[model samples]
Target: MSIVLSDQDKSTLRAAAYGAVSLMAAATGSPQKAATNAAIALRSATGLVGHVLAANAKDIELKGKTVAELADRVLPALTAAMKLLGEQAPAEAGNFHGTILLAIEAAQIHPDKANAIAAEMARKITAALDAGVAPAAAAAGPDRPELQKAIEEIVDSGFVGVSLRVHDERGEWVGSAGTAELGGAAKPPTNGHHRIGSNTKTFTATLVLQLVAEGRFGLDDPVVKHLPEFGLDERITVRMLLQHTSGVFNFTGEVYEDGTIAPGIPIPYGTTGQEWLDNRFKTYRPQELVELALAKPARFEPGTGWSYSNTNYVLARLLIEKVTGCSYAEEMQRLILGPLGLSGTVVPDASPELPEPHAHAYYRHGDTTVDVTRQNPSWTSTGGDMISTTQDLHTFISALLGGKLLPAPLLTEMCTPHPTGIPNMDYGLGVFVVTTDGGGTVISHNGAAVGHAALMYSTPDGRKTLTAALNCVDDANLTIGAAFQNAQQRLVNEVFGGGQADPA
Candidate 1:
């Protein structure tokens, strides 16, 4: 009595299920609509089943039957198919329910076969609902163990919380570990919001380059021409700013070879926890951040050497504002966010709350580490004030690589490398050009501030992308820092054809 669905039947079932669920969800606006849509969906699914059964019966080929005869014969065959399938119990009733619903609504064939499929699908669906299991949950894909392990390792690596989303040949995988907030048991939402750190630099560079595409500015144009207040060396150009060759002093304090820390404005490092926590809500202007760095000596002469400087991007932010006569955030929205439909991403001005269903991020400071999870991000400004989910990050990177954002030639120039004195890696415009031993190149950027870090990576063609947000239990020993880098490499290699490095 058991029915064994052929591969074609299985494929049809999957397609039908998806169609049914989508139609039901979309057409359900009110109680009346829901009822009407549900009925329509069920009828459509039933008709599809009838069509499939009728087609199967005619394929027997031993007797050359006319269309009417085939149709007549199909009723009994469909009844048998349904009885046999019912005895076997549909392995994925949730999937079948959806497919059947759609077939019923759209079916233009035999009504009897449709009714049988609809009845069985309804029975199974009701049973599932009565058991308090969502139909969607029952049809969910299998869990990814490898991705789950990676998330757990990140949580163990001293982050207050961590969440990751990865996409590969296997499709999208998302997972999270650790509490959303300090001393809380709730796990972070894998797609929750977090500070994107220096990843903002990539966006800033993209905007600048977009304007460049429009002839508003030239890459080689001197930075001083755009923003005369920086007192920048004439050798520094817009290209240098994006490439981090401007040699601007890092405003968030610098560490020399001898480990001398020349402090800039007060940040979360080695400070009283409460002071930073209190000021977390304060807003910082891009000019203010740049001015603080300008107050200090240049890390090296502009265009002479390379050093990572938040001040450089802050200057770029100012340039964008000055040229567009709109806030950097607004420009970002108009050019990127709005166009890409990245609704979960934001350029938070002084906002502390992440968009709903977000993970909590925490900062650690003082001899006894304290949780500063809910501080204002204004201090980071254009340097690292953006908030985004993995989905948005993936969408942005994918679009950029897929040529939705920049022209091909400009994107090529943006990804071109400048020597950073680091082997195997070079700094591209606002991104890192990481070359793997496999002779493959990945464009990526990793950023950290206080407690949160964002990692973004994409292949040259942008067909593949990897994006993650990590919130660790940051400490003096840098326990989380080391582990985070390893995790990043592991994921990159796993998704992009590489291997893990020494964990030490």
Candidate 2:
């Protein structure tokens, strides 16, 4: 299926695509160099998209005295370009979209300081691209209005935007409520990408378990055997790390049950407001993050108690790298993402690249609110630094539970629960096992990273699931934490037949 674009269409596409780079350059105040790099990235595209973008830009007029004026023309043009490409050549629609994002990335200057500005621009550009097509799905007519109400209530409860996907007996329903950005009218893209926060633990744990199944290492092997350089406790085993029974201090601060706080690195919550914003782009190596936690006293002797810690996952990530002689991201691709065909998922590592068509996330510092969507996630590492779409999450969880990614026995062990001091909801190797109100079980894990959050849940058999992404206005005080919890409970109760307690 070849796409034959009329000359006018090509002109519009070229102008829109190149004008996006101009917008990025304007945001960073580096027009000349940014334009040069962006042009190279744009022309680097292959196939039909390459030929179209490689065409001379001399005839195109990117008219605007100001960035706003330019965006007025370029944004609509971007949408029109996507609409025509999607209708005429759907595959090229993706290619065209990727090329534009690459150019935008190449156009950045001093991204550490310009991140919020550049991210806002990128969000606008992505929104325009997404606007070219209809939403992936919506709630209408007589089907699952309660489901729709759940997400709308999430927004009404102070979330900026929400996109939800459900797969059950009635087939799949995808819907979104609220605006993509503050003070904007566009709804969040139903299938957009998001930072899944600690949900990365499920993926990391699944990878470790898969390696264990293959005899690369035993689950009960001492963690020091794989990586003696860390001088980890000999009692800490691979199983303990995955199960969060390692008692390692969480690198991203901790809150005791007594309401006391132990601060580690500055993240987007607690007393980290101004400090976190100042160091938002600072990159922390996985080892550095783990070492920071190691410097703190252990919360309990290895295997003595259960506590959620980011360092455990960081150690797991390092173990995977040590055993496989590959980076965590590489093994993840080979074992999980590639096999599952999860094209929209990524282990960002130290990269702050949140892909296109995502709703904006924000953080408030007293009187000021800033877009925190583009901060470097290296601080969290494999603990919570992955990006994925709701569709990919549903696929991953369902497939993993459906016996596609692991052996049946190993999967059973993975889902086997350990008491996490929370009643009715127990911790598995890397997931939460909940006793639903109907006496059935649900396997789940949900996580939040500052202003962005994700909810991932599924029935025991994986026959039903609810996955969602949320964007909100966050504060150091965590004013939105209660709403986040209620939103999770509301959705789980409505979708999974009730009785979900204290999601992780």
Backbone clashes, each candidate: 24, 0
In TM-score terms, candidate 1 sits at: 0.71
> What's the CA error at residue 455 for candidate 1, in Å?
1.6
- C-alpha lDDT of all candidate models, in order: 0.63, 0.83
Candidate 2 lands at a TM-score of 0.75
lDDT per residue for candidate 2 within 94-177, as digits (tens), equals 456656765676677454464787779988998898787542122122366887888998899999999988877755566789
Off by over 4 Å in 2: 1-141, 501-503
CA deviation > 4 Å runs, candidate 1: 1-143, 271-275, 367-369, 475-479, 499-504
TM-score of each: 0.71, 0.75
The Cα RMSD of model 2 versus the native structure comes to: 8.9
Error of model 1, residue 31, in angstroms: 18
Please list all clashing residue pairs in model 2, or write none if there are none: none
- lDDT (10s digit) by residue, model 1, range 1-504: 223567445334433333333333332234244334443433322222423333423223212144234333333333333333333332223223323423323231222133454444343433332232232223232445676676677677566677766655544455567887778898775556677887888888999999999888899999889788778788889998888888888887777878888877667655433565667677676678888888888888778888777778888889898888999889998888766655556787777666545555555455565454556776777677788767678778877877889999999998888887776788888778888768788888767756677888888777677788877666544446677777777777767777323111
